[model samples]
Target chain A: MTGPRETLVGITDVVKHFAGGGNVLKREKRKVHAVNGVTLAIRQGESFCLVGESGCGKSTLARTVIGLNAPTAGTITYRGQRIDDLTPKAMAPYRRRMQMVFQNPYASLNPRMTVQTILEEPIRFHFPRLSRAEVKAKVEEVMLSVGNDPHWGSRYPHEFSGGQRQRISIARALMVDPEFVVADEPISALDVSIQAQVLNVMMDARDQRDLTYLFITHDLSVVEHFGSRVGVMYLGTVCELAETKALFANPRHPYTQILLAAIPRLDASGFRHTRLAGEVPTAMDLPSGCVFHPRCPHANARCKAEIPALKDQPDGTAIACHGIEEGRI
Target chain B: MALLDVSNLNVEFPTRHGTLHALRDVSFTLDKGERLGIVGESGAGKSLAAFAIINLLSKPGRISGGTITFEGQDLTAMDTDALRSIRGNRISMIFQDPMMTLNPVLTIGTQMVETLQAHRRISHAEAKRIAIAKLREVTIPSPEERFDSYPHELSGGMRQRVVIAIALLTDPSIIIADEPTTALDVTIQAEIMALMLDLCETHDVGLILITHDLGVVSEVTQRVNVMYAGRVIETGSTRDIIDAPKHPYTRGLIAALPQQNEAAQRLNQIPGSMPSLDGIPPGCAFNPRCPHVGERCRREIPALRALGEQQVACHSAEEVAALAGNGGSAS
Candidate 1:
């Protein structure tokens, strides 16, 4: 809800391909086309959400933006500065500014380490010269901010519940007071009630710390409640980008429409969803033009041959579909 | 008599520490072709109730009390051999994970044929024919081709379709699907749910759908049983319970959903996590997290009593309903 937006993270035509172990009998070399030419920006103090099914490269794109994985092609800029090509030593300062919270808190947290050590490890790694007392104070402050009791710091992760463990993970992320956070399905592992607690914690931290978020999740409801801007990704490419309300109210892309229609609403009178014809194709063997064209009902010959560019609309939304461009859908 | 009537079903696990009651006084009735949803968070014993109905609880976890009367026969009193006859033949189950439910090495055809032949006196050729027909019923494309494919060869959605097809092979009167679509994507989940609902209606099969997602339950179920801490806190028609939940926990659960509240606003979270079964609180298990907790709630366990169309087990159900009517949080 902040005004005068300034770009915090700028991703320009980024492509990340993993070298797939091709069929041994055929002896063919191929790359898993994970993220193919995605461009977007996370403005200052806004929650930018990426929604898609499994293996859609939302995670890969988040990782690429946060410098976890270098892009196979294109550039990732932090505050207009190129951080993609920087060395690990050179990327230290950026790492301190950018933090990540993963989906599963149980697996992300070490079983042996106490909560104190887990929260303290990040501070120690990022700020090596900080005193022990300073780090402890910071940990206590972060834990309190995230609604985790400081007394429970002595207990191991297993002692705490899933919600508490997730709060601890969020606390660890905020220990550095990061300007940007890439939370990949942070609350998906918890129950609905617990999910609310974690979401509130993240929202509170964002407000208090003035943080920008790149939230990746498959659950559209969370995106609607949490995100300011939403990007609908399908088969490693973002098909549509719009403000959260605009995306939900008036979805442009056929994929986005189907995805929105698929959500089982509590208010829905009956079970109804747009059933797509085909399942997600393997990343190793992507279709000719649009990855979704095979399954898309509105796909024409142009959609089968040429990849559509992201076209800006008057309503402040971007869509990448030939059907939308030609007024066919 | 109801098609399947479970009265005061108590399931327990005899651990070394003590006997932990996993499901306490869990009672519900599933009429012919009725779609009943058992909704709860994990460890709330919704799944345990489903397992208890079929006498499929694992070792140490057994149905300690109450009667599961199906077709005027007590399933709880039946021996293993007798129960085995009805376990899959009369009441089939579809588990959460389709991959785990199906055999990895065997082709889909072999597994389906074996299951059908085991329960019914049918030839292998007949079983195969029936299996393919069932596959076609579930909308699996090219049923013949898919029958020869292994479990791993199919996608997650296709495998779930296969699982549903296998569950329908015997023409069972009842189907217990525990989180049937929880493992799939939202789109796939919607498709599977639609197919399941369609099949149940057409075949006139009773369904006991156990899931954590209230949205799914609201969409798919005719009646819902809201379980909390091993007990059915509320039971009513889907519309009534979802629209005006009488129980504080039920209200909180519905309000806690992101869509229920304003976008970007703080969700109405029920404070604290679900109590573990072994250390469930005395009196009311939900007292710790409930907003409308009173002295009576902390001292005495409320019985499920009828309040109009809904049966709610809360000391302050009337108060909750009144406040909920005013668009209040019921605090």
Candidate 2:
């Protein structure tokens, strides 16, 4: 179900480009367009998923939104306040309100710190006036909420399994009582059974805390079950954005259709994927006009000459495809 | 006879503390041109089972028992040179990470030609010609141009295709692929899997696909083996196992998948993580996590018993079947 209707975070034409191949002597520089002109709105108390394959800039866009990386252009507004360009002191409060859960559980957690210390660090950092006993109580409470053993707080991250470590990661994110959590491929490293467990914990947390999540992942199946609104990204652009049900039922964009078809379903066998020609072009050397036109089956002369802006359809989906605009595909 | 037959396989790692049974009583058969899938979580010995078949298990790990027979010859009894001859010539293996499989230092052409010359008495030019043809077979664009390119020059999907080409170059009767598409993107995974399926069909090659993805297993393999904690807990047709699983673990695995239930609901997760090899439970390795665990399940192991088209190693197989039927109806 859709959560509260209020918009929590608004991203407008965010462009994040990284400098590449630059040296002091020659001064030859190249710009790698990681996130190019993307606009999205994340509603309160909803699981907004950014789905894309590798090199699609979904992770970079997420990092930029969470203030981990600065955007080269465009505005990111949180609760009607421009937070993207805020200074460190100005962004400190938002940092506590918005936490990030990284992809690799093995590398994300500090190997030297105990689970207790890791969980308490955020709470203590956010609330410096809180007593040590208060922080410990909060840590234990969050641990129990995530279905972890409270006593295991003394254990290091390396002592726990992948699933347990992920639970700890979730616990750490929930320590500050954040309103928004940007989780980038959190459970992609875990096993399938463990993935379900972690997902259940996240869903339970979402309902209990009334939190909004910006979930980023390459796994489409997880998005189908967990995401409320899905944003399909291709080559640093949001190709399509729609409600999960509508998108899965009637995908308007050709890239979205190809992605959904590529998912291997348990109900059927053999190849059901609509094969697309060509490969994803390098981000360093982007294609002209539409980035996806090289692999899209219905690309025409116009599609290769002009970029297609994401336009709203009657079905409540925002799609970026010249073919869809012209009813060619 | 089946192209590959493994019975009562037991792989162990000898440690200072004790012997760790990495794989216990793993048994399956891959017929000529048939595709078999082994599905399990990590530490379930699915990959180790595949490795042991080719005697490719790393040092400190050895097959303590069981027999792996390929074309009426016992692979377990073969020496190093004999195993080497059978490995790439008759039975090739594809690993999960193509980057790790392909030698980074060597060019694609050199690597392919090396594999060919290792198995066959062929000249460099002939081997190069065959390598290019195999590359073209895998649908690599401009095989001639890619021949001189290094592994680093290829994308993840292209590298996997190159690995597949290397596997097919020898025309091996059986190809054991362990999580072949796990490292690639979903679109690339679909294409690679389709290519593998097509190549296997055209060449009449037997395939033993070891993966944890139930969806991939259903689409690619005709028969499936559900493994848990180094044991094959269930064996049946892919259709039967997916549509009507008889083991509680099998049901739990299928139910744990996100597609099994409605959107945004709590997926039916199996309670605990899989036990390590040395710390497996005494009776049923999955008894601690199994919902339908009985007293007998904790005290004694259940042998694999035939139930129509399926074979399940669970004392409560009948109950599980009834529950699965009720689940299907309720859903």
Candidate 3:
């Protein structure tokens, strides 16, 4: 199963921390590490997924990748070039190479604007020299590329349903023809009957355009279905990374195993179930050593004190757990 | 004994054009300790079916015609006075969004105490004590501390837990959960569902869960009913509905799901969107979108045809049944 290096995007120990608010006169300053020591890579045209509960740094990592939030530490390299080193003004040219599709369609789209303006605005920013007629034509082309009817360009956001509006958002994201896209929970906000339709359209767009995706979601089942590579995040750190099949079939980390087991299998419903007893610990005060030790069923004294590094397993899967490192499980 | 029995229920809504028929001839019985899952796409009348049973349909929505018998009593004939007595005391409901069941301004403890006081005569201190115990029953951590917290302070998952705690406080004989976990992530969805199943079994309560998610239905429910535009197109045991669905619409939906283990260049999806309930197609509401639709299906609406323990409502039941058994792609 040896494949090409094919690394399109590389994240090297990225750390994004948000400063906490307090009295400046006589108070201590705290930092909430939204994403800590996160490192993963997406292949040229692979669907890389991140799965975890809320507040697990999944969205933080996605935001950091698309430049919505800058990394407080670490580096991000794109196509063998350092992206984190670029200034915001100098990063404008590189922005066309990467784009992001957000989760909420209502908040993402401006209610006052038509679909035409939403799609054209991106192209206007990237290629400002294009004439008015050319911009109109390009808007139609991009809209059609994402399966939105070109006629829909005139429709306002209020006229369309959730799925249709999301398509418009996709059109806006793909207008620049970016090689890499981060779709953050794109299908999560739609009705079940329409979720697959949106997923199919996005898959088609990805293949047609050779777009690499960083799909972030909390549902492991969707990751198993769509992601070529999967990473399990917990408490601001990546705990496991492997091919989708490898992660689901033979999950090495205890947190990932429980996450997978909790997704009720279609055939083995009710028969095989492990309801995690305790709630996810507060992310503000993370557990020491292994962040997942408090929830890990296989946790030991070693796991409680030492932060497990993401090391490659003999089977090629990357797991961050002391139990697996010590051959305890 | 059957805890809830809804017979030949029909609900209609007043609209600009005409009366919009929602649920039709929907008859379902739940024993004292039974788990039934009503599943269908949006606007498929699953939610209305639940609402009609408990007389919860408000305003433009009304149970125009129906006989709702709960615990051997006729609920349809009861006035607001009688209905209010049974609404939260004997039967409770949990909605998809936790905010629907909770008040934003009130503390969790106040809301719980108020709900308890609505049915039972108790002191405020006693009500607070019972509320704290109920919160603990739903597995809420630090109930003593959380009782003072507002709904906005809790996370989405925690808020849902509070909703469940309120729903279970009265120990209702029947609990109708309408897409309770749809707003949750899959991992949390499973945990909440497992908790509900245990609670039901422990309290000997009959459960009616309404959802558009088939995966959740097939997991948590014992029996399943597949609804179309506004009709129960198929009804049977959960095993029969998942392993051997009868109606064309049901089969199409099952096939449309992108299974985890299946390999395909493209995901299988139902070709067209759900037909608007404003005015459904000619005979079969699904005839326009149905792949196996025929002359009989387009001309005559079918009744529930019996097939062993399962019942199907389609003109081409035999053909659909045979196709379901043969395991051919439907959509």
- Chain B TM-score in each of the candidates: 0.98, 0.98, 0.95
**Candidate 2 CAPRI assessment class:** high
Which ranges of candidate 1 are over 4 A from the true structure? B328-331
DockQ of each candidate, alpha-carbon based: 0.86, 0.84, 0.44
The 10-residue segment with the lowest total lDDT in model 3 chain B: B258-267
Q: lDDT per residue, candidate 1, A145-221, as tens digits?
A: 99989988899999989999999999998998899999999998999999999999999998888899999999999
Clashing pairs in 3: none
Off by over 4 Å in 3: A20-28, A131-142, B104-107, B123-133, B140-158, B328-331
Could you estimate the TM-score for every candidate?
A: 0.99, 0.98, 0.92
Q: How do these models rank on lDDT, best leading? A: 2, 1, 3
In candidate 1, the second chain superimposes onto the true chain B with a TM-score of: 0.98
Two-way DockQ contest, 2 vs 3, winner? 2
**Model 2 lDDT, residue B1, Cα:** 82
Candidate 2 structure quality by residue, lDDT tens digits, A1-329: 54359889999999999998456688878789999999999998889999999999999999999999999999999998999989999999999999999999999999999999999999988999999899989998999999999999789999999999988999999999999999999999999999989999999999999989999999998999999999999999999999999999998898999999999989889975788797778888888999999998898899889999999998888999999888878
Per model, how much of the real contact set is kept? Answer: 0.84, 0.80, 0.39
Query: What proportion of true contacts does candidate 3 retain?
Result: 0.39
What does the i-RMS of model 2 come to? 0.8
lDDT tens digits, residue span A1-329, model 3: 13755798889999988987445786768678789899888789888999998889999999888788889999888887888878988889778989888898988999999888888988999999999999888888877776678988788998887878888898888888899989999988876657777888888887788788999998776787788889999989999999888887888788887787777555655624666656677666778999988877788898899999999887878989888888898
Question: Each candidate's interface RMSD, rounded to one decimal?
Answer: 0.8, 0.8, 2.3
